[model samples]
Target: MREDTKYALITGASGDIGREIAIALAKQGFHLYLHYNRNEKAIALLQEELVLFGVDVIPIQADFTNSDAISRLQDSVFQLDVFVHAAGNSYYGLFQDMPDQEIANLWDIHVHFPMQLLQKWIPKLQRSDAGRIIFISSIWGEVGAAMEVAYSAVKGAQIAFCKALAQEIAASGTTVNVVSPGMVDTKMNHLFDEEEKTALLTDIPMHRFAKPSEVGEVVAFLASDRASYMTGQTMRLDGGWFMR
Candidate 1:
């Protein structure tokens, strides 16, 4: 709570990628508001681990699909210098066969809730000397995936949202950007079998999937003062895949 301390809120802090982001920020002396929907035990353990970095870590729980999630989140944190939207899930299946409820959940979790929360937090972010807003989007957002049609759609929406929001808020000294990662080695990608993963490796010029920590490192850099001039940009962390 020191006046000189920097604070960051990272949603989905329990996930592998989220955990890495939390660790990276903690190492940089950022007091964290670690948000998670479920997995209390996971987040609690993460909090313990982060304390070693000498930053205050507060865990907040809210189901992004719930209508009142925005209120719950807004009430939990009083100060924020950075907000990272890392909370998301992918629906893998034919777009036509995807259920109405699943699509709604995807939109609510990835887009609706985060947008509303940012709306509430913008004023606070503007007060900071260097505020940051980062979205952990997917490479599939830039290039659509076959079975993940709905997921691709939501991720793409995130990219567009950051681009527009960045322009609107640049004058306030706050930057908005997207980190679109490709084929990260996490539980989300664990849905694919070993053979499937091998095939995916062949597609990536790096011949391997991204580690969660690699994504975290990029996010930490973006949250730092070094990224002051950067805004409304989507940094593709796709390992030479889907270059644009």
Candidate 2:
């Protein structure tokens, strides 16, 4: 909120990676604008933890699928130094088996929300001395996954948005980039059995799945001045899962 200070707006802050990023950024003396769609309990505990770090943590709720909620959020946070669009959902099944509405839902959450947020944040960020915009995409976005057509499409859209936005914001000292993580160990994939997990690991050079904190650390780095020259690129933290 202060010009002499920095603030981070992290969406999907209730999730594993998002929560880790919130903690890491808080430790870095960042005022946090944490957004969560549901799970108030997790958000409450996270708010308490962030406050323990002696930083301001504001927990807000917004359904990425809703345009009205997003507009309200943009109005609430007039200016932000950093933004991480990490809220997304996926359904794993045959493309033909998935409902049409499911595909639309993924597009709204993964594609439309990030685009709209950037449309609102970019100008404000341009007014700042420096700013960072990070999009959490996936390896599937880079190389399409067989059963994740809609998810992959949305992720791919994010990647495209990052590249184009990077070029648009470069002259303004605002960086836009994408971070694509591969097969992260999150509750979303807890449905996998041991054999399924092992099967997924066998293809990866790093046999073990990546921890959420591992991805968060990279995000913190990018949000820092260290990545000043880095823009228009999608950095993959996939543990050798996708060589791209």
Superposition error at 212 for model 1 (Å): 0.1
Q: Which portions of model 1 miss their true places by more than 4 Å?
A: none
lDDT of 2 by residue, 1-244 (tens): 5687888899999999899989888878889899999877899989887778898888899988788999988888866899998888889999999998898889988888778877877887788776999999999999999988889998999999889888877998889888899989999878789999999999989898989998888889888889988888898988898774
Global lDDT of each model? 0.93, 0.87
Task: In candidate 1, list every pair of residues with a backbone clash.
Answer: none
- Best model per TM-score: 1
Using Cα atoms with residue i matched to residue i, what is each candidate's TM-score against the true structure?
0.98, 0.97
What's the residue-level lDDT of 10 in candidate 2?
Answer: 93
Across residues 16-46, which tens digit of lDDT does each residue of candidate 1 receive? 9999999999999999999998899999899
